[model samples]
Target: MTPLSPDDYTAIRLSLQVATSATIIALPLGFAAAYLLAFSEIRGKAIIEGIINLPLVLPPVVVGYLLLLLFGRNGWIGKLLNHFGISVIFSLKGAVIASAIVGFPLLVRSIRIGMESIDKQYIHASRTLGASWWDTLFSITIPLCYRATLAGMTLMFARSLGEFGATIILAGNIPGVTQTIPLAIYQYTSTPGGDQMALSLCIVSIGLSFIVLLLSEAANRKMARN
Candidate 1:
């Protein structure tokens, strides 16, 4: 095994931290959006879904650029946040934001599928029994669709782990700050005598992804069996 440098270790740790943070932060939003897409009787549902799933179809670089526009110092939201002494551009928080944006579609899609899979009768019965949509969602939708939520979380986590384009664009790959596994790998590939290190990180990345995939499969099988 190729021995990792201190910076490599930091990259690995930061990747895990950033990925976990991004996925956790996006969970509630993903659930709400997925629920709306799956169950709501809203106009322009198709447009909402298209926008939600844009990241899946758009190039990563384009997504990164869009995030930069939204979070850059002169950007409206960025200007407001900056006035309060908070800045996302070129920071670890930017990395998290980038990851969340990039992985959001996957999160929403997974949960939406889970929500849609639930029988309509349950929702109807809850409504008939005087349960509000909120009550039905919390009691019936979330409980019965737990597996889909779990899958969505895992998928988002995995996607964030390998995030590169958006992270580097928004966070600038500062070592020990915003440098994640993918960024570190990019650096290795560009430097002289760094092939071995790059390969090591690649192996680590692949191992992590494969483990998540295996867990997802196991979860699906368990859900099916139940």
Candidate 2:
């Protein structure tokens, strides 16, 4: 096997960075979406949920293309960001956005399952005791779903790590810039005599994913014990 190059190392680092960033950026939004789906009584919920979970069913390439259109120079968002000197297309920010959008449904699904499992009696009791909605949410709802939230984050992080098509389209596989593990592997596989490098990155990707799962399970167990 060929020794990993500096660019490979950078790809590894960037993969982790992008995964972490996407997970962090998506966490709050995921939680809110879950909370809405689980507890809210708004009309058109089915429509809202369908939109939220659309990426899960759509081809990643399609998602990427849609994102590209939304963030292209002629796109409204792109124009607005350009005025502020912020770029999303073909950049690290674009990579994170792509990952977040792709992985968000998993996060929301996990958290929603957790939230739905919580005993409604407790929530009712909190409300009966004069707790505000926010107070009940913070004091009861979120605590009960902590494990689910962690699981969601774990799933999202792993998904982010493996994201390829959407990321390639939005972030462009620029070495040491937006290139991640999957992107680097894609590059290596296309280049002659680069099988060894691709294999090396695959091993790294597997190891990182394993570590994330282990840590998530450990945290869940610790929370259970507490």
Candidate 3:
């Protein structure tokens, strides 16, 4: 049982920050994506869905490499961001972006599942009552899918906490900056006599994940009762 160093503490905090930020940032987009996929009858829907879920199938390192190419100085996005003096490579933003991308598919999938479970009768009833599309979405679709949305956020947050390969590649694992729990553990394991520290972080990660699961279940049960 090794005590955590200050850097370890920073990593813990950073992990929470990144996971929370990524989940919050992705929630609305995930919901919209889920809604579109679940209810839309547009052409090329399968292609859109496949593109959205690409991260889930691709290796994290590959995702990171592609991101790097897309955000490098010569990259189109990089050039655009540089116009505003904003940076992504080797920064906390990059870590958040990487985590968000890696965990996005899970969020979308969970919410989509939730959306699909809703009975069409409710939607039809809402429309029959003269509710507009936007009204139906906010008042009906969203309310019914609250549990799924929460589940997606939980999964994304947990996944973000464990993100490593893409984060390290895009964010460079800088201590007290882009370093997170997984990266910290990787760092410790790479150093001689650092096994204890790595194990300590691993324990912390397990605890965090367990807490997330418990909270998600509690929320779901409360939603069920309401």
Candidate 4:
């Protein structure tokens, strides 16, 4: 096997970092949205669902553009962040944000399905036992659907790892910095005699995706057994 160069290693590490960060940041929000859609009677639930899924259907470039408009140096939130000496545009942080936005729908959808599959009897029993709303959610609902939550997280991480268009548009492809595996692969393919590196990255991405699939299957099997 050909050893990867330092630049290639950096790209791999950065890709992992970006995807992990994206997954961590989005997980809670995804869970909350999923729970709300599954169990609540919130007003405008359909509108909330549409807004959550918007990034899935929108062009990646448009997502990036919207991110830039909302988080650019001079944009409202960006300007506020800048005052604190933080910036996301053209940075690894921006890549994380972009990936989270794109992967969010998948996370929410998986969790929603999980939540829907849960037996309502358990919740009702918990309520009858005098468990509070939050208590029932944490002790009953969430625990019962843990496998589904894991599946959602795995999918979100895999999706974030492969993110490209939004990453490039929002963060740019700066090697060893904002450049992730997909962005690096794109860069390699654009240069002469760089197919080898691109192919290597592609293989790594495929392996990662396969592992995620395996984990999801394992989770499903575990759920079925219970």
TM-score of each: 0.94, 0.98, 0.98, 0.94
Candidate 2, residue 52: CA error in Å? 0.7
User: Taking the tens digit of each residue's C-alpha lDDT, what string does model 2 give over 1-226?
Assistant: 5788999999988999999999999999999999999999999999999999999999999999999988989887998998999989989999999999999999999999999999999999999999999999999999999999999999999999999999999889999999999999999899998999899898988999999999999999999999
Q: Ten-residue segment with the worst summed lDDT in candidate 4?
A: 1-10
lDDT of 2: 0.95
- Give lDDT: candidate 1, residue 104: 95
Ten residues in sequence with the least summed lDDT for candidate 3: 67-76
For candidate 1, write residues 135-221 as lDDT tens digits.
Answer: 988999898888888889998999999999888888998999999999999999999999999999999899988988898889878
List per-candidate RMSD values in Å.
Answer: 1.6, 0.9, 0.8, 1.6
> lDDT tens string, model 3, 1-226?
8999999999999999999999999998898899899999999999999999999999999999888888878888989999999999999999999999999999999999999999989999999999999999999999999998999999999999999989988899899999999999999999999999999999999999999999999999999999
Report the lDDT of model 4 for residue 18. Answer: 93
- Best-to-worst TM-score order: 3, 2, 4, 1
Give all candidates' CA lDDT scores: 0.92, 0.95, 0.95, 0.91
| Higher-lDDT candidate of 3 and 4 | 3
**Candidate 4 per-residue C-alpha lDDT over 1-226 given as tens digits, one digit per residue, 9 for 90 to 100:** 3456788889889998998999999999999999999999989999999999999999888998899998998788899999999999999999999999999999999899999999899999999999999999999999887887888899899989999888898899999999888998899899998888889888888887788789778877877798
